[model samples]
Target: MPENGRTDTGPTAEPMIRLEQLTKRYPGQDRPAVDRLDLDVPPGEIVVLLGPSGCGKTTTMKLINRLIEPTSGTILLDGEDVTRADPDALRRRIGYAIQQTGLFPHRSVADNVATVPRMLGWDRKRVAGRVDELLTLVGLDPDTYRGRLPRQLSGGQQQRVGVARALGADPEVMLMDEPFGAIDPLTRETLQNEFLRIQSELGKTIVFVTHDIDEAVKMGDRIAIFNAGSGIEQYDTPERILTEPATPFVSEFVGSGAAIKRLTLSRVGDVPVPDWPSIGQDTHRDERAAAVRAGAREFLPLLDADRRPLGWVPADASGDVLDRGLPIVTRIGPGDSLFAALDAMLAANSSAVVVVDDAGAYRGVLDLETILSTVHTDAGPAVPRPGTVATPGTV
Candidate 1:
């Protein structure tokens, strides 16, 4: 396997997976575990189903893979109805990882990963190659770990093997139930960070279930907070869930630390763009010199014919417009969280990066100072007056 493909192109509207008024009821339970749940998991996104215990989050996830059939409604994958898709066929195409790391006790790690391919009737050599490739992809050394049985490995290592096994068939959609939950706190965080990095590269459409709000906030591209019989309380960015909770239940569930959590969600878009001066790319050298003499800053932002951001060019790099060429640009999408904007900035090694629409064209540079101010602003206090007296402990 060459690892999952990456798309650096702009966002696409096609929903990789969709649930339309999906409902699930168990025999003994009086209420539906998941009630009329409607959600869309856009291509290459991580959507977290978050809630407290017995909130129907797990049920919602299981329904997608058809491990538990829905009582009513439809489930669509890539716009095709999968409500009645064959269980074995559906299961093979959708990767699944649970908190238990359900490895077969009798099998070696390599053989375990080869389970699906073997079931699909792949020959010995292809299965072996796939097992080795998957193991390496999940950060496990194939040579050392491949021959070991599940019992011979540590819990974290076992979990890694479980992840490798799920990805064995190169499934487009992944269903994970607290894949990092059972580990110790430090190990959990390490796994979470590693998963984030992995996801960035793999671009799999992931549906993750978790009871931990912090984990949901940290891991999700968008989060759906459920309220059991009450249905979905909120489905939005982690930042929106923190900054503007949909209900009291959401606020209480997200808890007292939301303001600080907002730091992780708030990005360059939260702040207003400044009215900084700029010139067209075709300006003459005499005009450019005059603009510089008149206090034009270095590294001016460039724009296309539509006033869409292209990138920035250094003032000293070239005096001629044609010589500047197309400016190198990096940007965060409008749908991205503040944290993503920060990551973009750091990756670009610039204090600011361009913000763009769902399409790849530029919006504007979201500077670091703008981000910091949004994070540090008081929760309820009005902007401070120059002569006002300060309260004892309020902003």
Candidate 2:
């Protein structure tokens, strides 16, 4: 709760990155790009710098890596004073990814990802292994993409390569400046989710820069909302920022859709999944029909022998259920956000979405009503209905 927005990580644990009175001034500029600002980034947590253009959010991030030298201030990395450290050596310890991807057009994907490792004097075998490891880590197949140039890949692929390159040496800290900004919305969302999944495994200390509020909400463990002159208007969790605006600028910037934005904070797993009428694929035609009729549901969810959803069969379907009705095209996992669940429902034009586990096993069904009830209520776990047991996978 400190004004500087330092996360409380106990007395013994120091911040991974700390900026004290950080200031940067450009030549011929009347005002400093970054004023005397202070912030702290805890280990293994993402701290987002969010603001409008020219608000100095990017400048503050650049100053940390010495991409833009601070005119006056202190930069500390893992309790070491690195303000005057060798820029090259300092950068090698911190990964950097930017909006444009910045991959060499002629360089093969493997070579691009191996940049830092090669520079650090890693042997061919070591560098090669690292390249393949990171490429796979970022969802690119090393065997296929190793020899392909940046131009050979799609925009999303290029961005993935860029990320792989940034993580070339397995740095403990990563600085991402609008890394997904240039991609299309769908691809951007995918990359965001992928990166978040990666972060969960790697647990790297990250400084993420973005002008988009929704991205900040989704990606940031803590967001530092900046104003002109690099002044931090508010620094808090996304839930706090949305529910309790510290200032008028914060309120206006968050806009009037705060309720809708809160959906990003709750994951599908956190909500109670209600039981729906389901029939196994092996069921006989007469039994299936009887079950659907007795259940009185409009659609019957058909599950394979492994309890994995195959599709939904309409109530009036005849003969083989597998041959009829709509395929389960859109599905959500427990890790997905409620907003994503809602999106899946709308995209599939269905009233409910099939919930699957990590192994694609059927968990339960999430309907529109459950989502709305969560939104209007206190955001706690929903009450399980009578006769329905609430397992880890269900309400």
- What's each prediction's clash count? 2, 0
lDDT of each: 0.74, 0.84
lDDT of 1 at 380: 27
Cand. 1 TM to true fold: 0.67
Which of the numbered candidates is closest to the native, going by highest lDDT? 2
- The sequence of per-residue lDDT tens digits that candidate 1 reaches over residues 184-223 is 9877765676677677768889999999988898788788
TM-score, every prediction: 0.67, 0.84
Determine the C-alpha RMSD for candidate 1 after optimal superposition of all C-alphas: 13.0
Over 1-395, each residue of candidate 2 has an lDDT whose tens digit, in order, gives: 32354544322467899999888988998988888888988888888899899898998899999999999989999999999999999999999999999999989999999999999999999999999999999999899999999999999999999999999999999999999999999899778877877887788999999999999988888899987657898888787788878888888888888877887677788898877878888887777777777885678888889988888877777765535456887878876678778888999898899988878888889999998998888644542211122122222
lDDT of 1: 0.74
For model 1, give the 10-residue run with minimal summed lDDT. 386-395
